[model samples]
Target: MGIPLLENRTSPAGARPAERARRRRYALLAAGTAAMLFAVGGRWDVPLAAWLFPVLLLRFTRTTGPWAGTLWIWAAHIAAAAFWVYESALGSGPVVLAGAAALSAVQAVPFLLDRLLSARLGRWTAPLVFPAAVAATEFLITLLSPFGTAYGSLAVTQHGDLPLLQVTSVTGCYGIGFLIAWSAAAVNGFWQEPSRPSARPAAACAAVLAAVALAGGARLALLPHDGRTVRIAGVSPARTVAAAGRAALARIPGGRQGIAAAPPAAVDPATTAAQDDLLAATRREATAGARIVVWPENAVPAQAAREPAVIAAARAEARRSRVYLDIGIAVYDTTGPAFGRDETVLLGPDGAVLWTYQKAHPIPGSETYKPGDGRVPVVATPYGRIANVICYDADFPAMMRVRADIMLVPSHDWREYGRPHTDKAGLRAVEGGYALVRQDADGVSAAFDGRGRVLATADSFGADRQTLVADVPVRGATTPYDRIGDLFAWLCLATVPLLAALATARSRRR
Candidate 1:
């Protein structure tokens, strides 16, 4: 009796050791997820990383329970995509940490659903279901995000791959994301059951890839490049003084309108200096045979409409150099406490104002200006139909809906966020099938064609005064995305609930 009792006690201890081993396995799995996500973030600059990211992630999370898998998915996204959030935190504080964690949670919902659906569905359905869930979530984010930004999307990673990126013309970025996610899921399915893996998923994935390649290849080959090319130059000033700062007397290299006196009471002297700098830069570009000269966002401290001197200087420059000018300025009215419109004005070669449009989207928290009533205007120019949008406005695809040959973006970015900010906005060109010319004060200024190809770029951090000159193709090709809009996204959204129901029924059956 005593020997039997001792053996029973030893068995309980042995079970405890097994529990410890199980806990260790979970920890290792979480660590692996973090590593995979870190690699995925490199997709922003490294195109190949996009295809390679989901292999480990889908494989590791497939075996876990829904709740645990959700947590792991959150961890993975935080590891990969939280660099921007962390950078947004000016200092290391508890608030920043909590904010970052909250952002990660919000972003993880789609990936969590991907894992959960894959677990519930049979191997045959996992590949299709998983990508649908991700597409649905991304579509919702575009609808709900403050500025309608799809910034961290995996599709943007393929911006460098012109053949692949042309897919955006049909289904927008969501289509590209679906293909990548599907491939990852298929790869995961193969790894899940190596010896008895089903051939159906692999064959299906290959068909989709082949179809996309063929379609994109044909489009690139057949698309007409018959439109006239416009010689555009972007003028980016290295430093800008705040509205409150004392005006410094700086001589513009080519223009006579050097820094002038400040307006009485309302205007700051710094406004005069900023205008002087923009006019000066314009002169230099115009001298270099640039027919259109663009200035960065907030190049003029005050609104050009309200301030005569600001418009006067720009008009003089435009007339003197025989070039078109697109200038960004802030408009103010004495209505509310924070009343202003971030606006862009287009001046023709004759120095007459041709068209003006307010920015549709204003960046939240960072910008205090009230959002502009949604308006997209296309101006007829000798070069082509031109559309104007401010920095944050370019983030929203819907805001970019217009028939235009070229889109002008007057942008401003902090030093740390230059490349990512500029590169991400380039996707809009692919979606809308328009060439993009962006001027940034403290970021990477770039010109991207309708195919999402970077023609020329200038790094502001690399020089005090940076300029980009490129002959951008006029918008000749109308994309299916512009015609049909978010049809694929809506389809995924309607399918997600059905997928969830199927998953739930499958879970119960098991």
Candidate 2:
């Protein structure tokens, strides 16, 4: 016998208004529960997001219209992204949740678009719109406001898939994002018996990832740290940044004791000796043919090229010691901050000033500065082709900028964040295909490889730090980031608007 037919209509033509209201209420409640989970993303969690997908997929597939279920899902997708944004900005709070809810409202455009696209393209194409548009919007928004990670991005969900992540080495993170999403799309499309699911595309993608991982792993496994022991030094001498003029005067070496404005030429014996000692040791190592000698971000407060005295002294030391020096010196454009920003410079052998990358991005409330529009000059040396940046600038994926083999991230981490800074910086290394050199004053000054593994770690900052010189392999291949440059994101961007237009036309047509 058939079950109770609540969905059955008493009237032959249609349900009565009161019955319709009752059914509508039931639908609304179901929508609300789905909406809440989508907002909170409980489905992706231990018992939630993962299970949610299949059920929702079925709901979508079985619905009368191709786009029937997506509006609700997109609403959830956006809600989660906004929550992440709030979490990043104001920290976690009820207000953040509120912001997330409001932000979730931004889903209307995509939802309308998804429905139209689904109706037109039919089955599964609509689903792809969600990830593609989401990625696009995330990329665009990041261009406008540098707030929060792309938390709603599905890329992070595949974080554990080492081989899958290998695509990052060539195309950056977005390739993996597209792959995982497309994999989900394929799985969703074929799992229902009418269509045969070919695992080949997914398998091929996975295989390529695995091969890259194996190759990278093999290289790292065989590589060694700076094999010989050397007494490397890191200094964090306090210098009040109140007055640039006074600071320059204070550079008169021992003249710092005088507490008087002194000539740039005036020299203090002890302070001079200390700086000279730094130079002397650097020179000694270089003379001893040391591979690399590193210093903290802004090792010397002044820009080298612009400052004759600083340059003269560094060259003297470089020439005297013949050591390849990598010190983070603030490149001051005295006439005016070039692009109104100070930059970090890497002085190579013979004081040739091999690599000088102006920071491509700046942090808000940034005591830090921006680089010039001229060039992001990457230098070549036996150590590696290098892309060097200072402190906070490292957070940006370096999208829209030139690529590099090794990134010299000269940092000065503060007390608020310590070792985690090093770990987070490793993200750049992972995505960029290099072991980054993170040398900071008050934190975990360490080295990490392209795989986000810390090849070497440092002691707490400010403890007469020792230099960590490692013999990293010089690589020339493009990373996934280099090739794609936010591929998935751009795809999303294109899909969203196109979907919207189609939905608009369809609405008018109907």
Candidate 3:
């Protein structure tokens, strides 16, 4: 026998009111759960919540009329987005709210698609619709949106779960998202139709997840860490020095604008003390046996004219200390149309300039630097094949797919985004099978092995000095994702239309 229909016209007219009331309760619960768990930074961000909210929301939509379901889901999404904005560093301005609303509208499309298409298909094929829609939406957002994969990715919520995260090594983060969405769809199917055959899909999803976890665990356990390791150190200015520099800059005549428009002579003095501190820290770390040293993003701020001198000082330091130095600097240009340049200049032991990489994806509204050509720079060193991408560039998986042993990310973040942002960057290490060293100014800095295991961490906010040292593997592991590159997301995107057309054709036959 088919499952008992709830609240539809097929039900007795007298029972309709109670059924609708029950479904409304489900909708409310779904909305509340989504609001609690949707955002990146929040107290209620439980991983299980990511798997659960979708199920309840799907059930509510499946039982309701198309228009009612669409409206309710949109409202739920809007509430979730607003909650996220409130928790985030992004201020809740009218423009941000409008953008969030627009994004919420897009986010609700998967639910609408599931509501419209699932009933038309057979039980075996029905559960695929929601996941396909969700994955497609996420993939499109990552591909086309300027925000990149910084927001709306369910995989980010599950960053703490390493075993499940290994799926990203093959399918990118989109695979993990797909599995989560598929689990929701599968569970809902089993909930609606409590028959033996209907249970197979849910069981299959569980099996797949279990298999993924087992395989991931095996990979993590079996991966040889006995290989050669290199000592690397990440450095940022002392809290006191950083504060003093900011104070000095704040005294400029035009306030924030003055720092950018001020003459090189005026800006140089303000930042000189902090830059000296960072260079000194690098020398100290190098003395302590760190062959490669890194400075946090914009650890040195200089005017365009003074930047050459800044580089010359860093080069002299690296040459004297006989260490490789990755120097992060912000070069302000008073005459140029662009505000400044945010970049990392790599210097070899011989004081030779290796490669200079500019930040490719600057944070949407906050950063005004001219972006780089989106190419990751990799060079072979004695330690390993090293690659560098500054800060927000790590968020884009497509750009981060370089075949390098070590990925150096120089970042700067506020207190609210520090740990979560670093954890998100670590996922790229797992995906690319490379050791990742993220050195952050005024935030949490971290280093992770290729298997996503933490090597070391330093919180600039908590510590007096932001200096982190870690021994990371010299050789990078090979992963399927690095070669195939988003094939699973592409497949998910391709399946949505085919499933919809099949469902449409099948509905006509009935």
Best by TM-score: 3
- What are the lDDT figures for the candidates, one per model? 0.71, 0.50, 0.84
All candidates: CA RMSD in angstroms? 5.9, 9.5, 4.8
Measured against the true structure, the TM-scores of the candidates, in listed sequence, are 0.84, 0.60, 0.93
Per-residue alpha-carbon lDDT of candidate 2 for residues 1-510, written as tens digits (9 for 90 to 100): 243475463563477776675555446436544443433312232223432443343334334243434555555555455544433343445545554554454433433443345445435344565446545544543455443233333344444344445555555545544544444444434443333334443455456546766765665466433432322223333233212333554555432123222332342332343345457557555555565666666555442333456556776666566655666554433332332234554666677776655555554434435544635567776656676666656655644244665666767655435454455456566676665777776566776556665556665443443455554545634565766666646666777667667666766777
Candidate 3 local lDDT, 1-510, one digit each (tens):
244544344744566687768757675557645643554433336777788788888877887787787888888877877776666566876667777787778778998988888989888789999998888888887788766667778888888888888889999988877998899899999988999999998999899889999998998888766679999999999988888877777778864446777876778775688778988899899999999999999888787778888899999999999998999988776644456889999999999999988999987666767889998999899998999999899888899999999999999987877777888899899999999999998789999999888999999988889888999999998899999998898998899899899988997888
Error of 3 at 167 (Å): 0.7
Tens-digit lDDT track of model 1 for 2-26: 9767756775346566566566557
Best by lDDT: 3
Task: Tell me model 2's lDDT, rounded to 2 decimals.
Answer: 0.50
lDDT of 2 at 506: 64
Q: What's the lDDT for residue 501 in model 3? A: 95
Query: Between prediction 1 and prediction 3, which has the larger lDDT?
Result: 3
> lDDT order of candidates, best first?
3, 1, 2
Ranking 1 against 2 by lDDT, winner: 1
Give the C-alpha miss distance for residue 225 in model 3, angstroms: 3.2
